[model samples]
Target chain A: MIDLLVISPILVPLLTLIVCLIPRISAKTSDAISLTSAGVLLACVSWLLITVVSHGTLTLRAGGWAPPFGIVLVADTLSALMLWISAFVAFVVLIYGVRSGPDALSPGHLHVLIHGLIHGLMLGVNGSFLTGDLFNLYVWFEVMLISSFILMVREGHHSQLPGGLTYVLLNLLASALFLSGAGLIYGKLGTLNLADMAAKLGALQDPDLVNTSGALIFVAFAAKAALFPFHFWLPASYHRAAPAISALFAGLLTKVGVYALLRLFTLVFTPANGFSTTLILYLSMATMILGVLGAVAQYHIRRLLAFHIISQIGYMTAGLALGGELALTAVIFYVLHHIAVKSTLFLVGGVLEARTGSPDIRHHGGFYQSSPLLALCFLIPAFSLGGIPPLSGFWAKLNLLQAGIETGRWLFIATALIVGILTLFSMIKIWNESFWKAPASDHPRPATNTGGRPFLAMLSLCGLTLVFSLGGAFVFRLAQRAAGELADPSGYLDAVLKGGTL
Target chain B: MNSLLLRIAARYLSWPLLVVSLWLLYRGHNLPGGGFIGGLLAASAFMLYELSGYGRPQRGFFSISPFFFMPVGLGVAVLSALPGLLGGAFMKGLWLPGFELPLLGKVHLGTPLLFDIGVYLTVIGFILLLADTLNDESS
Candidate 1:
């Protein structure tokens, strides 16, 4: 049902939070609801993905108010993939939180805040994916951002204060820009709905105004995605949060931003603005180079991985900017691949930090010697992120490179290769420092580090990463098909406009 | 610190501002004001009262957790959207027969109005909640 597609994802978590508010329920009860809700969401998303994949885009108009007057939740292949990914990541994190020990996040309203953030993110992601209206997307953006703000500020670390401040200010500025862009689009087009705007955009008389609106909107997504200039906030804030939370943040948040950029540029604004394509390509290259460089310079494992996230984000954009069947297909594949690899690295990094009682790489060594299993767990995804063969990252990269080469983009192909190498470099840095070397001294380490549970969680995530890599054929093909669907937005526009499919 | 003009202004300003904001909230359906603007106006009115120290309700000062209200606002907003699914489509503005209020004319109220009110409470709750947190941090 359209209702199940749009509302259930959000409804499930919100219901759990309400149950959590009651005092009679203990931690066990809340965990059951939270975990069960995640499970239901997973089941729903899995079925929905297959349905949307077989059939074309599906639309659920809010209140069935028809086009230009109502909010619509439309699911195509790409959005479905993203929804599936978010649900999958959240489910795994919930698993880790349960199986692992006490969640290390500060405890004042922590549970509520965590659950609330999940609820908010679930709504925001679905709304962004499903929405066919610009304003509706903005509302979802606010929902997601407010949730992130709470998570960012919750622990109240001295370090987090500036990071949080910068994050708040930057995102607020993006919000304002987003609002003004919406106003401009609404004022000029006389319609805020996405599909309607597309029709109007194609026939626009004033190139400057339309181009300006398009640029502003892309800027908003860029800021959210943390592309190059917009990316400084990520490493700072992502590094400061607790690991499980960091794992979630690293995995899901920026991808939403990228997803928006991909959706808007590929579907709505691609025809109106050609300059955005070239501009985004150059920015993507810069983001890639700088992100990898920034990662290489960092010693703290998570911070390094966080920096590399932006670099890999560049790969996703590369596929879109090149703008052909292969390139778009590649972008979709890269997006999915990066989501898995980045989250694994962040979580594994967390596991390492947890075991060692420090995040700095130089402060520790010989993890592989003692906790050989955990070291091996960290190695899989790290190597995969570097694009070693048979890994998902490799398949994702090969496609992007192939897209670039086929388009005769030598420089981009070369840059993608360099970034891939650098990705390997940084991952190796993590490996050599944190896991590979012999211990410097005879100091005693924690029992948990020596014990195998935390390592097991990281190992489980690594296993998933490997699955994504080995099974890259299936997901990459889905991404290719989804990207094809996105390249042509006519069917999507019509489906949402009329209640029934076109 | 209280002044006669200041007190009169504070008393009049708070209630009037509150009233106007509420007006904005109701009229948002077809007017310039909506949940966001109305909530902000209402919040500003209460903020003025807090600043003027007209009522020294320490308990009131910290009564409702604003941070907590943000999620509540979110819940309200989401709940407001739930009625859409049962309808023929998503967000289809469900309605019952128009009920006549005592003073006003035929108010053909619907879920949009409920959604608006949810937006109102959420905004009011969120603003004050953030304000409360920042205040606690500073003091």
Candidate 2:
């Protein structure tokens, strides 16, 4: 029965979207339906997290058929953690959408489209994490891509189409590469079940086929994650989406790519291998430096944050490259911190955009005097994102640095530190332009009442990030446990394969 | 610019096309033809109707929004799986014992059939929606 809880998070949003889709469902009713479902989804995922903790790993064979033949949904510590975080983020974003109303929801059909988008996203993401079959993971990725592409182009805004085109074409290409790799793997092994693949690959001892397929899959995830040289599509398109949509994209979308990378590298491709580890290390460093550098050059707040997302991804991958328990732990912690901090910043950007009719920092000012609450929320996450001490980012970065030194990767360590300083410089740049500087001469007067809903959403997300800072000990322990689970997939293998035998 | 020939042909052909689509759908469980092909076949029938009826005011069944098919079909498809929940797992296929129909011989039912029907409706709905959108934009 607890195994059933795994699908609830995916089902709730989908059901809500169905209800909302009913002809003539009022926008208000639709929004109510969406919000309630999101809240329920959060509860379902929380229960899943607790269940996975107590039971170790939970696997469900769809249709009651055994695995290696039937579809399998497996939830270990890592998948559970991701679901918990995604559900929480989805709930907050839903509230933000509700509070902000029609404009925030965007396009015709209002709540119907928005909820449908969220539903598709949840289904894709949760399925990706829970699936034990490699091909099923690809199916989930397509599900996620289609839904997100719709969301990106939802408004039918003129600029959106071009951005949406770039986003769609690149992602489709990535999906093609991913499919080809899957086809190759299937051809070689004759099995698409991930656990089964692990068992088979370990036995087969063919490096060339494995490395080629691995590299192909890596490129696909890299494109999705927006790793350097493949990241131009992100900043170009992400900024064109509505603020709430942007926030959700900023929060969860790319992280799926990161999760896929982490999951594959740990489970299927061993870090002890030479070329793969070196490739991940160099790519991670380049991603970090280039991402923050792009951020430093941006004037639009959302574009700046979008670039920062790419950079933070580098940090997580770098941790993976470091290849130890502590490094993996750092990667997981950094993902958690980055999701909360990045989304909070984007929501803050939304509120700012709502209050002042633009996302351009040059057109905004006087938040220090007028909206102290917004200013405080902005500063906390901004500083945390910059790796200021006592905040979540500091602890995440410190762990990664420690992992680097322990691994004896001095050059990568230097790259991490340099990227950190540049990241701080960029954060300060946003702070100076948006909050610290005097109001631009033609800036609109700050409104006293900016509505409680968006603020509540921002505050709650910020509070989550703050909780990460204040309760660093507990969170780090959880990440440590998740990393341990990730580093060794035998438990996952036992659950899937042994469960099949029964 | 409406094609009188297409209109006449479509008016006579639509019902048979729908029947054929149903035939395809019925054979889909173990055969090559399934909900997807059936749905497309059904949508093509509707597409023919739209082409023949071009520039006329949308009336009767045609007037109903094409977008309606997408959500309703999706809902039905998703709900088809709920019966599987009753059986044990989320998508576990359950079957009814085959029974003789007066005219049709033996008939069997399962959640997968329901799922197929749902997909059929959704694909038809999506095609209609696309056709209608393009038609509206051109006008």
Candidate 3:
């Protein structure tokens, strides 16, 4: 029974994708199938989380083959937590996508196809989180990239083509780099199973080959995670996709990259290697500062939010760079908090665009006067993202800041603080222009009846943000336990290699 | 392109190619031949038929839209895993007891064969979809 739960995240989405692909299924039926599957996934992941909490690490060997030989799916506290949060986010986003009506970007016939792609995306995300092999992770990334590419360009608008092309080309480049890195690792270590690699990497005499491969993989994941130099594709492409897709991408995609970095760096490429850790540290500072500066220059709401996504990724990387039990805790906590807050903000931006007839804030006004609830919905996540106290983002940042201060990384700490301020500046800019500013003569007042399913989606996420805030201590403790597991992956290794019994 | 000799050859050769493809798929359990190669072989046969002025080959085995097979194939592949889950681990091959056949001596059936069949259909569907798209472009 527990074995089934471990694989259900992948299986549920896989089944949904198959169902969605059935010809002649109405868009409504596809919606029902996808939404119900997402709900089931969330329930299964939640149960998996409980099991992980009680059982330590759960590992399933495909075909019952012993690991170091067969493919394994390992779910530790960290993976389970990541899975639970992503499942919840996916469910809420699907609801928002359905209730928001037909996507303005694509035609009605494409609705079912989009759901199919979304399920594909979920399958990739879940597989990436759960796979215990490096090569398997790469395959999952391909699945995710294919689905995301279609989701971005399915409308085939002329304006979307350039962004879509850039997105695909850059990501393909990343995939190539990733494949080569895995190849290099396999050639040296003679195994792609993560636990086996971890065990062998420690015993290897010369560290240079491992470090080189680690650097290559780090660069690839940095591109996916939108780290400083490789972040161009994110701002170029994210805002051009459908609003719900942009929200989904913002919530899940880069975070998968971060999760990979966390898993590999902690487990295989330890700080003792001295290359990846230092590189991540310096690059993260640059990513934070540059990302916020980019956000400050954007007038388009979604584009600005896209830049903030990059900016916030810096904090997560910063926590990973800090390198301790507390820092890893902060990284996990920040990831959970950011996925909810960033996606909520994007959803609010979608609502704003739908109402104002533009994503440009310069043309928008009177939202506070017209719809206080929408305004409030926007404010909670925005303030939380800006790191206001008692909110989820505050605790997330606070934990990281504590870690940074403890490590005496004063330069990195200062960069984080400055970036936090600039993030608030950008958020306030959106507030002033879109909400507090007087209505322009050309501006249409947003429709007042914000009571339906769309609002329900927003309210549910806002409610989650509140829960994150109120339950910050509880979530932090969870993060700490997860961090402890990550900090010492011996439990994970034993679970996989020794055939952990459910 | 509409040579009578080519058309005659296509008509004679297509059925034989399909039979050989199925033989390959069935032999894949212990031998090297498998669903992927067999599916490619089967698709090539249809492609040859279409190339010989058949114009999409709409009759008998080729009547339905190739796109229809993708979901069915994927569904079958997923179903094959369920029996494995019931017995023990997922994707574990569970076999039916072997039975004697008239000429082949004995045959063992299993979920893996079902899985291979699913892959076969999916590959055929995928290739035909690509061919169909290219055909539309050219016309």
Candidate 4:
């Protein structure tokens, strides 16, 4: 039963994708099926979290193969938490996608296909979170890349092609690096199972080959996560997709990269290795400063939010670099907070564009007068993102800063503080220009339709952000437990290798 | 491209190729061939006939849009996992007792065979869909 639960997150989405692919299914029917699938996924993930919390790490040996021979799926607190949060965000985004109407984003006949792709994306995400083997993780990444690529280019707008091309080319390059790294590791250790590799890595005399392969894999994930030099693809392509797609991308995709970094860095490549740790520390700082600075210069709302996504990733990397129980906890907390807040900001940007027919903030004004509710929805996440007191982002940042201070990483702490301020400055830039300033004299505002499903999506995310703030202690405890599990992979290793209770 | 000689060869060769593809898929469980290669083989047979100047076989069985097979294939593939899931683990092969056949001798059947068939169908659909899209682009 538990084994089935472990695979349900992947299974549910696969079934949904298949159902949605039926040729003659109406868009409405596809939406219903996809939405229900998302709901079921969320419930399954939540239940998985409960199980993991009570029972420790859960492992499923695919085809009943013994460890080191066949594929395995392992879910500890970290995996479960990531799965639960993503499932929630996906469910909400599907709601927004459905309510916004099929034609709003996709052309005729492509709507059902898009839903199919969304489920495919979910299957990939869930598989990535649950897989215990390195090659399986690579396979899941391909699944995600293909689904997202089709989703981005499905509308066939000429404007989307360049972004899509860039996105595909860069990601394919990353995948190549990833495959090579996995191949190198397999050749060295004679195994691709993460647990077996971790157990075997320590015994190997030559650390250099392992470190070299590790660096290759790390670079691949960093590219995926949009860290510093590799961050260009994100801002270039994310804004080109439809709003709901953008929201989904902003919320889940890059975070998967971060999750991989955290998982592999903690389990397979411990921070004890000087090469990756030092590399992460420096790259993270650069990512933070540059990402926010880029955001500050953007006038387009979604573009700005996209840059912020990169900047926020820097903080998570910073936590990973810090490398302690506290830092890991903070990273988990920060990721949860950032996913919700960034997604809400993007959805709000979508709503704004829907109303104003422009993503450019300069041409927008007087939302404070016309749509106060929308204004409030934007304000909460914006403030939370900026780390305002009593909001989720504030606590998330505070935990991170606390972790940094404890580690005596004064330089990282100072950079973080400065970046936090710049983050606030950019958020305020959006607020002041779009919400506070009077309507531009020349540009006409379209008719307002503010009370619909898009608003519901944004509001629900805001509600989640509020829950994070109000329930900080509870969430923090969960993060703490998850971090503890990550900080020590003994339980995970034993669970996978010895085979945890079926 | 529309030469009568080429058309006669394609017409004579296509069905035989398809039959061979099914043979490959059936033997794939324990042998070298499987759904992917089999499906590719089957798709190529159709492609050969189309290239012989019949613009996409539109009569009888081939009239159905290749897209229609995708869901059905995926459904079959998913269903193949059910027996194993019920037995305990996912994708765990469950074999039925072997039975003798006239030409084939003893044959063992299992969920893995079903899974290959599913993959066979899905691959055919996917490749044909790509062909259709390319055709649309060219015309």
**What is each candidate's fraction of native interface contacts (fnat)?**
0.55, 0.66, 0.68, 0.74
lDDT of each: 0.76, 0.85, 0.88, 0.89
Let me know the DockQ for model 4. 0.77
Per-residue CA lDDT of model 3 for A1-502, tens digit only, reads 7678889999999999988887888877887888999999999999999999987888887877787888999999999999999999999888888734433324688878888899999999999999999999999988998999999888888988898999899899998998888999899888999999888877774478777888889989999999989999999999988888899999999999999999999988886543458778999999999999999999999999999999999999988889999999999999999999998988889888888778899888888998898899899999999999989989999889999999999999899899999999999999999999987668665553433666777789999999989999888899999999888888888898887757
Better TM-score candidate (1, 3): 3
Per-model TM-score on C-alpha atoms: 0.87, 0.95, 0.97, 0.98
| DockQ for all models | 0.36, 0.60, 0.76, 0.77
Candidates in order: C-alpha RMSD to true structure: 4.0, 2.2, 1.6, 1.5
The list of candidate 1 runs beyond 4 A from truth reads A14-29, A98-102, A180-183, A205-210, A271-273, A442-444, A449-460, B1-77, B99-102, B105-109, B120-124, B127-139
- Candidate 4 stretches with Cα past 4 Å from truth are A99-103, A273-275, A448-451
Give the per-residue lDDT digits (tens) of candidate 1, residues A182-258: 89878878888888877777777566766687788878888888898899998888888777778888888889988
- For candidate 4, the per-residue lDDT at A124 reads 96
Give candidate 4's whole-model lDDT: 0.89
Off by over 4 Å in 2: A99-103, A107-111, A272-275, A445-449, A500-502, B1-5, B52-65
Docking class of 4: medium
Return the clash pairs for model 2, or none.
Answer: A63-B92
Task: Give the per-residue lDDT digits (tens) of candidate 1, residues B29-53.
Answer: 8879988999898887766776666
Per-residue lDDT of candidate 2, residues B9-114 (tens digit): 9877877898899989878998899899999999887776666665423786545565678787888888888778778888888899999978556887898998
TM-score sort, best first: 4, 3, 2, 1
- The A-chain TM-scores of all the candidates are 0.94, 0.97, 0.97, 0.98
Lowest-lDDT window of 10 residues in candidate 3 chain A?
A98-107
- Candidate 1: what lDDT? 0.76
